[model samples]
Target chain A: MTHKKNTKAIKLVTMIMLTSVAQAQVTINQKLTASIYSDNKNGVEGDDGYKLIEERLEIRGNGQNIEAYARIDLTKFIDAPSSDYRDDERLERLLTSYHLGDWRIDIGDIHLEMGRGIALSLKPIESAGVDTALRGGQMAYQSKKIEFNIFGGEANPANLDTLSQKHVVDTPDRIIGIRGQIQANKALPTIGIFGIYLKPDDQKLNELLNAEKEDQNITTGITIQAREILNTFDIYIEGDYQKRRLIDQEETGKAIYSTIDLTIKETIILIEGIYLNGFEQRGSPHTATDTRVSYNRPPTLERIDQEVLETRDILGGRIRLERPIISEDYVGHINGMYRIQSPDSEEEITQIHGYAGLEIYLPDKLAFSGGYRDERYSGGALKGEKLKSMIHGEGDLTVGLEGYELHAQSTNELRRRPSDGDSGGEKRYARGSTLLGLERGGRMGLTLEYGYDTEKEGVRQHFFAGIAHWKFLEGQKLRLAAGTQRGGVKCIAGICREYPAFAGARFEWLGHF
Target chain B: MKYTLLAALLLSLSAPQSRADERPLAPEIKGKSTQDELINVADYKGKTTIILFWATWCAPCKKAIPEFIKIQEEIGEDKIQIIAINMDDAQTRSRVKSTIKRNKWKMPIILDTDGTIAKKINSTNSAPYTVVIDKQGKIAYSEEGYTSDNAEKWAERLKKLSTEP
Candidate 1:
């Protein structure tokens, strides 16, 4: 089934290319980039290195009344000598758009924004591995005074392979959604309404897990963004609401998320809140599905239902200010934020963070900067009350003279998270961590960085990073960077995954014709 | 030949090290500034000019302004000139100033506002950009995003620039 889908996509792309070829007025431009990374460590045996590479191609075209773009990433990886990296797969994004007078049509992987808020973002994290590329279509129309747009697509889960590995399901489950917006007077204010219908394709999964049928997951929301322009001062406000459906038998569950943002000169303030009253989906269990010896492995669907019922709510806000102390040569800024999350069953968590920094310029093309951040997080989980706090400070200085430049930075961090009553499941934070780096650039630039991190009672981490960007010929560039991160869980965004002590290196070359 | 080499060495040695003294004036634009002004490194003067590089899509820059405002307030007006350079493309130029006004920014902002200047400045294709020009027209400092400690150091640099002849 997947193969058939791939073939269909290829045919569609080819047909589009051919059609554009026939139309002499329409021009199509294409570009491709490839990158690879490898790794090796000291204590580890075997090759100790894995090579991952990706090739991306994009085609774009624009004419008097039409414009469109499409991109795809073809991925390949070499297995670690000791462990097989066999599950890697290739992914593609194809978007085609057409403009007819004031109306426009778009098909394939689509992203949409309503008002000032991002209502539909398929790829939330491009670097940290979370790629939620929605596959669907959209249509929009605009006039001199107003603009309207409607979009619908399928939501591909982040970890779909977890379910596929257990059963022979050819097609992963999907979530479908639709959104609309209206913008009046491109200068003044715009209001938008958006709604989505997420239906899980669980036909095979229901049979495999012996679960009952479920209704379509539904989400609907609205946003209001207004901007008031005065002679000397401007005021803008943006707010949004989003609701998600939680299915537990006939139990109806919903989650609402909203954000309000305001800005003044070098100052900006934002307040965001979220409340979950229904079921939310947690991550996959560590043990495989077949491991049911003493205690029954929690059913995946049931676990999802429980998560939705847990009722999680969060409220947060951030404020920032920046100003020039000495003309354009020097500037300073300060930022602070506070967040609190409360779960229906677990202890509520509260965090407060603040940071201050400054930059300076010297007469000899030398620049230096330093800053510090203090953060504290305290909360309780299913086990007992817990508290964690950290204070981190860092400074960097760079000197650029003649044809060469040198840059270095260092960070010192202290973290502490201790449990009150629970000893077995208690969490311990890093007592101290430090990072240092230096880089020099000229005809051939070189960078070297080292880091050492120690936890109160957990793991100690050591990291080394090096990179070189070399100019081979005129207009041609070659870059090589290698780094090793030992111990601790590596994370992107807030999501985390554990990898054994590993070292990695990447090399790439680029040239334009 | 000996005289020419000596002149060359002297010229290289005498090249102004400060961005303020070295930066040339905004050249005569054969055309008007109908929001299409090109922003190369040559348009600024006198004080160390800190350009706040920003884009409409950058959340961090948007959230870091309060700190920037406080720093500006503490630094006073005569010591420095803050130019908020918007990186919005030409298509979004119409909304640039209005957005600034709506955000209540008091700083004088040029429209690089169209992103042309950002591309020329070798920005990292990211928003919340901050670039510092020395008194002699040289790029003294540049960074993406805002942090408190960096803000302090930026102020310190401005102070240093003030004392330099």
Candidate 2:
């Protein structure tokens, strides 16, 4: 029944599009891409291969004061036999937006944001990890000083595969959200207030499991920015509150988080703190009692209580400094962050990280740069007085001449970790990595890299990667890259996710007219 | 000797295509509609397309939507298409639609839900991707992350794209 309804809706939209084509100043745009990769090892060593192809077309125009836009991505990917890898093939991202003076309405899969995005989308990387896109809609109105917005949507379950199906799940069937923000006048500095609300779909929850009610989560906050502070310093502060309610369980919880950031000249600093306190919600089982276990375990009924892993208080701060040492010829930078996590009854965990680097340019068309980083992790339960420390240093040198260029970089790291059962015994971890590249004018570029990691336990892994790109025509290009690496956590952001050591080669082709 | 130095300096400054220029424009899409024919950058001649590349798995993209919508409204529909492309896979389509219906976006949406368009646009497997295409179909601006400045620059590009051709 739902499929039928959707088909009808699609047909209705297509018909409308066909009819509007004649009246509007229509335009069409298209893009295509293909990528292929192969590996020699299976799940553990990277024995896998895939070929992916994608094409897209879009149309847009305005008629009678109403403006419209639409686009589509057609994609296909070859599947590997490994169960750990999943193939993606389908059409994605379909929606439209309309405008009328001060008010605008967006429908379909939509993205949203509120305030400085501290309690929301706060991350150095684009993904942010804290929030994901949603299939939803949003409406907003803006005046000279104040803007109002309200949005509601549902989470996409494509990544739900990351969760084990055996758990008592309350996958949100639908989510509705609303928010509003007011900006201060230019003369008064930029102060703002914002709020958000999220409610889950009850019907879908019931269908997925025997939950009595759908879970609902709410978050709201206010932000303030000061411009006239100290003439050169900018200050921003935000505080937020959140609540989550689940069905069939007496557990419920709420959280509060706050952030402050200050910037002065070439240096900027940020401080953030969050406290989550409440009961264990239904369908989630990780309680506060479970000690130091890998958080990536698949979901299961036995882990339902894990969701209520007790009240947690986290505090972190980051500092970044950038300055030129010799006018535009040389530069220096230092970035550092520290975090402390404390659970209601568990031991506190502390992590300290810092990186410092400098860049220099020579009079002979050559540039050089290098950096050093140190990370220390400690605290928690079973790991009594244990510490994991890592230090990394790297330098890059590039030389350029008429129509030709050469670049090279070398990186080395030393890691140490306390033995599992022995308190004072430490293990040695060392790694060295390097990259070299050569390019000629606009015709072609080639790069090669090698990495070696070793531990005191005689466990060692070496990796190599080489890539080449060739520009064949005015708007055409071809690329080939191959790489193999062993035994290292593939980290996106500071969140470390492990990918089995693997060797792979990739090929790509792109063109435009 | 002076000429040799000058030539060498020019060679040092000249590099391959700027990583910024290779960014792809987000797809533009419209559902079957009655009054306004939903259009993307491909539908206009005098305007620029500000493709806002996003994904269901992206957090900053979600946070930047309100700003994008505002920029779109401020730019006015006659000038640009603020295409918010979602890089979700096909299995996630139903949820993508639900999100669209729920958020009430006022711009035309292009589904890269399967990630096809994202790859075509040169995104590094992440979201909150953005790019601007001028009336001449040339990509004028591109970025991988979201910020208030990103929106402001996009609005600026709209003015430039509309005026160039």
Candidate 3:
């Protein structure tokens, strides 16, 4: 009887193994970038010879129910501006996830978002090497009508902020959050509720902020959304409340974000509003190096060209309209916004902004698009003496030339401010860039670019660069760039990443296997 | 002159004729369309699929998407499936549906809210990246940025993959 039972179990195990083997598949994706540079930055981090080599590789593996990702970096400097021989190699990111029926569990680095990034948002934006991801664990469940996630982790901001070429050592905060959603019937459609609790390490807080205001914050929010209403309109609204417990005091805050998009007779209209009263979520309040890292990024409700504005005290909104011009190929739009910012402070300011753009698609594989924007800020009343103003324009043109294609791009922006010395002619500052390139299929590409800025500190005002791109194999490309590049503030969404200027000859090879 | 000739010859090895035979599997994509419909990449595997990563602020993407729409209309949807994944960040995400409607985009749209899809596929966190996966769930062609003149080339690649066994 024992032998018979064992034989039956063995047969069942063999059959299951065979089935698993039949459905098994594995795939790996990788990205490797190599940079060789020799720079002449005048007085900057210039190299005498081209001996500084940096390599970064990101690899991801996927199976039927599992995924793993990692990023590794290597830097080698033999002899540079000074006599230094250093070789560094380390792993930057490691993430893994497993998928089970109706459940997914993730460990290592991860990104999370809730209700348009009001409650939580941690992601990457590539400009000059400023990308932030959380090092934590998350468990999510999804079914037909319900979804929820339980996430907790520590913050791991990017180590290097390329703009300053300085390492960022941030206080790692322990964050825990829960978000759940359900799809109710037709009228109420979707409802979501979320709560996030953040605790900053006391040691790091004391070291950075002088041992006085160790903040522990708790945030709870709710979002309600309705889509496809009458087949023409969609609306969404979110409300947030914050309870801050500081070492010396306790403070409470509230915020609201909302948007409505309406489509009627081939034209689309949108209205958005945000009211933030001291409810901003910061991952690290103050780093050792005097930088602030944020976890939640609420909508700015304005153009991104503006510098990162203070969301601690503000009430603003915008309205936009877009329609087709001659045909669907030609599109046009106009946008305007008004806001009173920094109301709690003595020097409050009111801002008004306007923007217009058009897209034109012509015959013979030709397309042209352009946009112009004007923004004004007043210290007292609407249409009063302007505290500052900005005007910007950009254009893009693409045309087919025989067997090759030509791409031309240009951008210019001018900023003016009230003259402080009385002899200043509006104190004008401007920046502009242009590029022209030609490409043929996947074989070859050649490009030339020029950029100039009037207010670039610690770097040259003019930038001239030439590049050649050659593509081959499955997913590989080699590019060579030789010239000077001026670095400045690159703002995305509501955050800005400053990059360092460069004047060098660099070769880069990018590929995946 | 000799070194230049040698370098040029070696670089030319990556031409179409010497392309690699192995195809990397495409990353998983699951999101909700602007119409609030669930869009999953796994469900559509029997035909060639073209996935376009785009955003509103990216002017080139605006140009590339329309040309792709014309291609799909001419090629017939029965043979190919094209899904445009919007990579708009949280601030600009609300404008996607309206942008599509105003532009008269005749394609299925998906939202990458936290940029999870773009990251999984190594999109460099930028816009106008295009990817093509054949019926076997393998990446057949990929391009980082788009140019207007490459429309015909993209059409040729898609049509060829659609007919492959």
Candidate 4:
């Protein structure tokens, strides 16, 4: 009961439940964004003139059912801070919530998920601007089938030098959790339970692994989940066990995840599995399972791509198939995966992945799609052990006339190795893009784009103009872009992120309020 | 990596030609309407509204809802109102009210379901976005996507917002 008296009794019960959820009703909303980045060949810090000026402000407030939020970020580089006063490179986020009666309380920075987030989660992957929010305290409850959640926190401590030295170094160490659920509505099927506690801060793991340890380790875990089943086959399963006590050392770990879904008459099938052992593969896979939260890393199969064997000592399986080919405006898809990794213990690695897709609809205004992917790797850390392969292909097309709109896209890749000197000398890449648009009735639009990349033998051109005039404002938007861009992976619901390459001018102005 | 699509289309044609002629009001938009009534867009104060938003799995909001129902039947609703909205999702709100009542679309339709007034006007991440106001309610223009040359620039900006003032 001493960790500075339990952090001053959780900050005096979060300042008396946020001062009784701040009386009455009040409102305030704000959003502002500004971005500018200059000529940077090959990005994510490849350093070439590399200019960037980003600003963001978000403010929210509501009272009555209580709500409060804050976000501020500002950064300037390469022309070194001349947007005249950016309050010295800012960075902040805050939140508060309250709702009494069936309970729901939160205090400062928290974004949580429990059942399927394995044990805990604070999602946000925004192309790698990973924000794992949690400077926390939370409590939730619901009736009519019972539910519960409890939290205590510390995370959100990455300051990548807050736009270069605005401060924040290492501050990791604290987490507490509780999750519960039970339902009897759909004639019983849901059940969940979770418990977590962690306390490690060997100086924030020696400032992210520069090494330095003297035990402080605590770590503990437990989870169990069971989801709907028999409603035309819908079953989800989870199990975890953990224990770590290292002042003198002691460890125990386990993990397993499962999913099965089926819906016939119009296809839909999914089967998934994951297994882990030992030191729960360094636990903390951003606990809060049921996957989803990879603004930039931390997604272990949900639309599988195990990010290179997520946390090693593995065993994975996946099979997914979706349907509606021919009639439902054409559609067909498939996915497959297999994994058996060990990370290290001398030879024991295997991975395989496959994907297939098709979508086609044509009746007055064309549309088409195509896909293929295959990957394989063998033998742990293969030095001379051979066996590696990769193949990918993609295609898309769209055309709609009468006011004009056309689109085209393509992708290709191949890779193989017998030490890259055999197996038909593989290794190839391709990229393509094309867009042409013209609009006038819905208030204006003009577009032209052409992009290409045979792996960097660049070529890009884009011109876009849009207008929906009200002029003075309502929610202003003006976007302008100039040239060379090639950076992949972007997803906004299925989470993915990774966007880097850029070359030259880009402008965007959006307003609401 | 040298850019030259005619100098980036002449610098995006000089960034939208600088507009900005007085704007501010807008930002309140209450919901329901596809007969569930309870509309409330500042009670259409003195006309000229627009709104739009849309979503039916967006293909430019299904090609911009019949060009905003042919500019709300050639600007009439007592001189401009439009509305539309419908950011779909209540499991597709009865297939978007049976596809806007089988495309009869008499123009005023609301329903932002759970996106609380399109996240209170932030337009919940694009979907054929649109907004316009001016009948002295300020907020004049906004657009996101949908082009066939934007319906005669939204009817010459609603015929100069019906001759402003």
Output the number of the TM-score-best candidate.
Answer: 3
Could you give candidate 1's per-residue lDDT for residues A1-513 as a string of tens digits? 543474357438633642452232221111222323343343335534455554443333333344334433344546534322333332344555565655777666554333222223332333333334445667766544445566655533332122111111222334344544455454654555666554544444445665565534444556554444452233333333334332434444344444333445543333344444442322212232221111001011110101111123444444445555666345465656555555333555655666666655442122233233232334444333335555666555555444444555564555555664547454544422233322232236676767665552233356777777765653255677677644444433233333344466667664311
Winner on DockQ (1 vs 3):
3
Rank order by lDDT, top first? 3, 4, 2, 1
Runs in model 4 lying further than 4 Å from the true structure:
A1-388, A398-400, A404-513, B1-123, B126-145, B151-165
lDDT tens digits, residue span A161-273, model 3: 43443345645677889998887554557888999998765446455656576678899999888887898889988999998876546888788988999988878899999
Candidate numbers, best TM-score first, in rank order = 3, 2, 1, 4
RMSD of 2: 13.8
lDDT, candidate 2, A1-513, per-residue tens: 432343345334533542353143333333455545455343333334655555544434334333333444444556643443344432233344565665777554455445433333311122312122445567867554556667665543222122110111112334455555444555564445555544443344445778876565555666655544565444545555656555544343444444334445544343444444441112222111112111111111110101111223445554545555666455565655555545433565555666776656452222333333332334545434535666667676656555566767776777777766646687877877788888664357898988777752433367788888886863456778777755355333232333344455556664432
DockQ of each: 0.03, 0.04, 0.27, 0.06
lDDT score of residue B63 within candidate 4:
52
- Please tell me the TM-score of chain B in candidate 2 relative to the true structure's chain B: 0.68
Candidate 2's docking class is incorrect
DockQ of 1: 0.03
Better of 1 and 4 by DockQ: 4
Cα-based lDDT at residue A302, candidate 3: 65
lDDT of 3 by residue, B1-165 (tens): 332342233224213223346565565677767766667777789878889999877767877887887887788888788899998777788778787876668777888887788878744556788888898877787678776667888989888888888
Sort the predicted structures by DockQ, highest score first: 3, 4, 2, 1
Candidate 2, residue A292: CA error in Å?
18
Which candidate number maximizes DockQ? 3
CAPRI-wise, candidate 1 is: incorrect
Q: Tell me the TM-score of model 3.
A: 0.84
